[model samples]
Target: MTVKMTRLRNGIVIVLLIEFVLALLGYIFISSKTSLVLATYIFIKNIIMLALIFYASSLINENNISVSEVLNDEAKNAFIFGGLGLIKYDKNRNISWTSDLFTEMKINIVGKKLLEWQPLLASLFEDDDIKVVDINSRKFEVYNSKESRMLYLKDVSDYIEISKEFEDQQICVAYITVDNYDESIEQADEQTAASIQSTSRQVILDWAKDNGVVLKRYKSDGYIAVFNERTYRKQVEDKFKILDIFKEQAEQLGQVMTLSIGIGRGSNILRELDELAFSALSLAYSRGGDQATVKSNDEPIRYFGGNSESYEKSNMIRARVIAQTLAGIIKKSDNVLIMGHKQSDFDSFGASIAMYAMCKAYGKKTYIIIDYDSLEEKTKTVATNLCDDERYRGVFISPLRAQELNMSNTLLVIVDNHKPSLAIDSNILDIVSNKVVIDHHRRGEEFVELPLLTYLEPAASSTVELIVELFEYQKEEICVTEREATIMYTGMLIDTNYFRTRVGTRTFQAAAKLKELQANVGEAYKYLEDDYDTTLTKLSITQTAYRYGEGILIAFGKLDKIYSRTLLAKAGNELLGISGVKAVFIVGKTGKEEISISARSTRDINVQLIMEKLGGGGHFSMAACQLEMEDVTRAINLLEEAVNMYLDERKSE
Candidate 1:
């Protein structure tokens, strides 16, 4: 009924009959006394042998390969492929057969599933693609064929090693600078200056030699380090220990000069890598130095260090030039609009009012873009009072009103924040073309692409400090009304946390100038004071604080109620004044699914780095982040993890 059976019946059957007759005749001839019984016995013996041969051939044909072919061709091919092995498995993952190479390797796979013999190979049954696996300390590339239920494996240990070696040898570029070199050197005594220069010169060269980085000093305080991926990877593994080296040297000699490093990787072009390195260096430089920034292709920028106070700059010439430039632009524009960040705080609104006074002095019409319905109680009260005045009936306008205005040749000034997403109404940016950014917060990666003018000085106590400085260089004699001066003073007071942080000589001078303008300090203090119920709530939040590290404090608000962003910040500020406290975090609920964390520090630790781990950023002293889940416990847990990670990174060195 089968093909082999038909072969026997068509031709092989006739041949078998002839052979049987011949064998019977020869036996009869040899016998002395032959009988009919003897011939019948010989026929039966011949037929039995023929049936056995047919059965053997039929079994071999089932697999579509003869036994001789399988034993010869497949074995020869397996040897030629250099450690190639083939396995055939059924739907149940049982190994039905294996090539001769498997037996040569002494791996008994025929009677067992790979799940028992080699679990890694079992993954091949789930997909029809090549994968690498380890077997007996050797690497193999396995190609799976789902249609045939077969797996082909070839040794790939040598190839993988060569690829790794190539990657390790790839080039990386770096830029380094000594932070505060020029300022401190000019102010130091002769002997101290000499020591500073010598220390700066030797420390970096010694590090470069030890780390195998090729260093070339281009300027007195700048160097370019060229190294391979292996050396760069060493820094990543150690968390950039160079930052500690710089910090230690500064502490030993009083911070004459510290270091900032920027690394660029994942580029084939040397010039592009150099540009990326410089870009990364600028981020570290802008963030107050004593840090390292890494900018790799297609990866988000990363920051480390910044554990110390940033050096301050007081450049009057730069301020004078920016003021003159801004005056020219404002006088030429048809009108102007001043905008601050969302959820307007004292500093943000105060800076906007200062800029508004300047625009009015220029004799040009300008409006402050604000969402009045969302304004703080004190700020809204101020706006309402000003609206009642005859001199400022149309000064405060909503973002929607600004959008409806004729915007031709309008100049937009953004105060207190540079990131567009934080703008009072981010949609205003789409309608306005000419823009300028002014802020005192530490720089982040998000920024307006191009602007007519920009001033970002993190050293200043507040943006109001910078605006007050610009007041001196204006061509037209501009005088802010008494109320305007009071509002501007409030901005500076709140941002500096009562002149306790980021204060400089210029900050006091600006405050004195406002005092001369009859700015009421009493009114500014009143704005900072919280209502009775809010004060009690803030105290409760701060009182629940527990210690984190040596000087860090962590606390939370009522889990069932919503608190203002300002409330959490105020609680964090109060906790910073506690005995021996260096940093504070106040966690609270803001929305149904949003949890807010406000962080503050006293220069003993960098809170920005800790908060950045949770996707929020701010100055070294203050920062905040949000978690999108409703679980207050989870928010606190994540904040603790961030704190632990930050301390762990610093502790490693």
Candidate 2:
């Protein structure tokens, strides 16, 4: 819009100037007469030209307000193209300009009389480093060496005055939450919890009032405050220290507190500010939470933390509600479609099948979206058999087929992963807005908004366990059939390394529930049974693995179609168990598909951060990423460097 307006204004100026010249030349040639006649003709021509210029200028100015207003708010492209200017004003009623790229230009509104205006104009020239090319009683044009174009008279005075109205609009809201409050409270007795809450509230409210702000308690641990820039800046030149004050206050109260802060500005457009604040708070949480941070669109993130412990309780009740909601959605929808990450593994495929069974129990039309031709032979066999069953006839289909059949009423159950980009048939997501995510991985960005339900427990071993827990919560002990229970049990076994890794009370309880449902635990182990050839291949690949850093392991090998991811996880875990090993990483070429990398770590290290550097993230103890790097050696070298850097940073810290 700004570009178009600029072009239109320039075009009109050039056309008018051309017409003025043509008129003058024509008048001179046709009316060469007495002096009075010639003078009158020149006067009329000048007046007409002046009127045209004013009218043209007015038209441009008339559109400038709306154009500037829209560009300020709705111009998403302004970040790439220059955005509209924001007029600013000081407390003393002085006007200024602001933009990320545009410099502030202050113009003095001078003079009660014609002569008095000269001194004000001269002072503006001297102070602003601008030069006045011409000055008249009611108009002036100024030029600056730092920028192009002459400043128009009305823009300097009238526009600047109008911009002052934005001064009082500076009162802002800061949204803050105490991170890990549930865990903190749970760790303490009732009296201690009350004391801590009272202490925190007083500290926050007192600080807010002292800083000339009003603190409004929203939720139990959340607050919104009104702040002015003047008061906020006076409190902290380096505003990051505000978080330190919170930490100090919490320490003095004999407790720990971590704050997630979101600062909002812009009066008329509070929603944008709210979004920015929410995004900032989310980033703070993702970076392990417990800090006060400011997020202005122009400012870089300012984090403050002492690397404190962050352990919030997983929302088990919410997960149960989500499951019940998902069950209802499947019953109502025309079809239930489930998908998982690409290069489906035991957990992914197993979880998908489990969800399919749950939907089937409700007599809903269901399909498991898969890359049939590209999937592993074993998986294809299971999927084919399920489709061949009379009950599941016309249910199983390729991701491409599912995309065509999906509609708004279709219920999508994205399993084993929440990241939209990682899901099979990600594009199909848009067709069905009614969706649920049953994932056990830690939350990451890129989740679909407004999901009908989401059951994500980062602490849970697998989506299969979440499903099992959901059944227990619903008290539907007999809803899952023997076959479905076996599948769910298989997923839990694969994810937990047959109850050897990440096994907890809930894990054993889930297994017991499956057992009660008549699931053949021994038959579930049959799914884990591998042929001697595949076992030998994994063993040989493990023999080739090399140690990197204290705990990380690296190996490159081609394996038979089976035991690629399973072997990778096994190899990584095997390395991690070795003496003095803190973490492990295994990379391999599974099939003609992309290179696969798996990472594992103990409590002493966070392998998730390492993989996040490679555009992947999971639990701190386990993670994986797939890159398009065809050269395996180069990838290994890069991964080694990443591991070394992470280890070195931990040591230094």
Candidate 3:
């Protein structure tokens, strides 16, 4: 109540108190007739005063509710009772019954309450001599003292949510085998090794049996399991610690097991399932082994524990293997077709030519697919010079012609890229059953799988080095034309920025070999030169570069008809020249078809992680993706946030 209203109520009570005091005093001392009249007047006035106080307190207390505020609408509805004073609250008979001189009618407000304290009518009486009664069956309680009158408020609320029902669904099957099991065992004594293997096998069998899963023993070293969702959940939550279990059990056995798990979900198509399972196993091994990974229909790809130490690959062995692989490809396929990523750059195109020359050495019919007019004039001049020669007449074909020549007898050789979607002629991929993917880029999500062979070394500067390594391993004096050698060298120089990035012992060796093959260094350097306008364009765009966390971002407002991915790929490397930047992202306006985004990172950051958020993924260091967004500004904003988030997370860690 307002202070004014409270004051008015206080004034009326005080007046009543004074009148009662005067009348009581007169009744004891004055004449009997006068005293009786005065007592009756005070009694009526006291009754009227009590009624007014009740009206005021009841109205204020009811309007101001504390309990209703605590209870939600759903809870409030459940509290309303019928008007018969027989309010039922479940099976409990805890309600207290009482009676008063006034009617005992019960009221329930079926809405939220906002009262902070309960009101008492006794507080309205100004006279300390006033009395009140609380009547209970078989008992009489009197409120004769003002100190006993008090009110208190408290909040009470609790709720439970309904859970969704679970259905019986098919479960995916996953199996694990330690990659270095044999080596770890061989290091142990005969008795110790035997005991370790036996104990480990028993532990796996017992765990599977207790979970009601069926296990099939494969080669005494690999065990396959079958399970559904209920079983799988138990396995992840319970059996993920199986490695720790094995560690404890085999402590005295003198050996440890490093596990690699492979999982596949679908059952009807065993071939596809087998391929997927193998891929999962490969991924697990790549992750340094020793973990569990679950695969199902929901995940088109596999899952593995990331950040594993990769297996060390020897350069000589890699080169030898690739040479043999190339020879086998020539032996199996009748024709060899080579191509690169779209809007082929000097490196991509040069790598294709190198692969084509290698194929030609095997007396195999080879076709180099390219868009001659789309390249820079220097690149176009070089390609035109090579194509005009009679020896290269049947070798150079347009993308359309390459698409038409698709056949099962042909081998599709994809260089500088592993992503089929970014290929020059993806249709060629669909037509040729046999394929070889040689790339320097890190593996991405949409990389072409099911290849006859694939050599993906992210550490290499360019695919040209891959071809050079293959040629070196062959040890045969295969004649490479001046133009082919220069093209390959130009591509290597472009990707490596003149031996600046990821160029190691092998890169230098390959460069030496290319130079020995009479590659014109001056001509290749000329191919990298750009006009004054293009240089100004690059510099102008770079001025907008800004720091985000440890990374840098820049957007190209204007770019020519050339492919933006190639341009940003160049720009991303350029941005990395700025100090303190571990990663860089370049966004540019391409044609109406797509917005180009290129991301590059040093060892401390993974640009692919940011790109993957936009439905694109690439290697840990350098990656490019096309945003389908029509608005370039919106795409850039989203990319900026992504880059910042990635760097922030890295910093926090």
What TM-score against the true fold does each predicted structure earn?
0.84, 0.62, 0.59
Best by TM-score: 1
Q: For candidate 3, write residues 132-202 as lDDT tens digits.
A: 22222211122322243221211111111111113224545666675445655767788877876788788
User: C-alpha displacement of 163 in model 2, angstroms?
Assistant: 17
> Tens-digit lDDT track for model 1 on 1-653?
46866676557667777877876786777763464466677588767866866676666566555555766766666463687878888888888998777776677878787678777766666654778888777788988787898888888888899998998998999999998787778888999889888987788988899999999999988999999999988988888888788768866878546788988988889998998899999878767788889898978888877887676765577799999999999999989999998778778888998898899889889899989877766777777787888777888899999999999999999999888877889888878999999888777888866789888877788899889889999988877888888988998887888888878889999999888888999988886777899899999888778887788889996776888888898899888887798899999998898898999988778887888789777788988887888988899899999999988888885
Q: Over the stretch 1-653, how does candidate 2's per-residue lDDT look in tens digits? A: 35776677667667766665665666677765554465566557766876876687777677887878887885644632432233233333233433332332333432123224334444443566543323232222343322322222322444444555455436656788886566567777988888778877777887787777878888999988777756656544554455666767777756667677766554446677777667666656654555555566556554433233334344466667776777677778987888887767667887887777677777777888888755554555555666666766776678888878847578888998888788777788777788887887755556766787767665577777777777654433236667667767877887776775566567777788878888788877876676887677767767777766545567666432323565677677666667776667788765455566788766566776678667777766778877665666776777887877666554543
> In model 2, where do residues sit more than 4 Å from their true spots?
1-174, 183-188, 194-217, 225-270, 279-315, 374-391, 406-408, 473-478, 500-505, 544-547, 557-563, 591-593, 644-653
Residue 170's lDDT within candidate 3 is 50
Residue clash pairs of candidate 1? none
By TM-score, rank the candidates, best first: 1, 2, 3
> How far is 560's C-alpha from truth in model 3 (Å)?
11
C-alpha lDDT values of all predictions: 0.83, 0.66, 0.65
Could you tell me the TM-score of candidate 1? 0.84
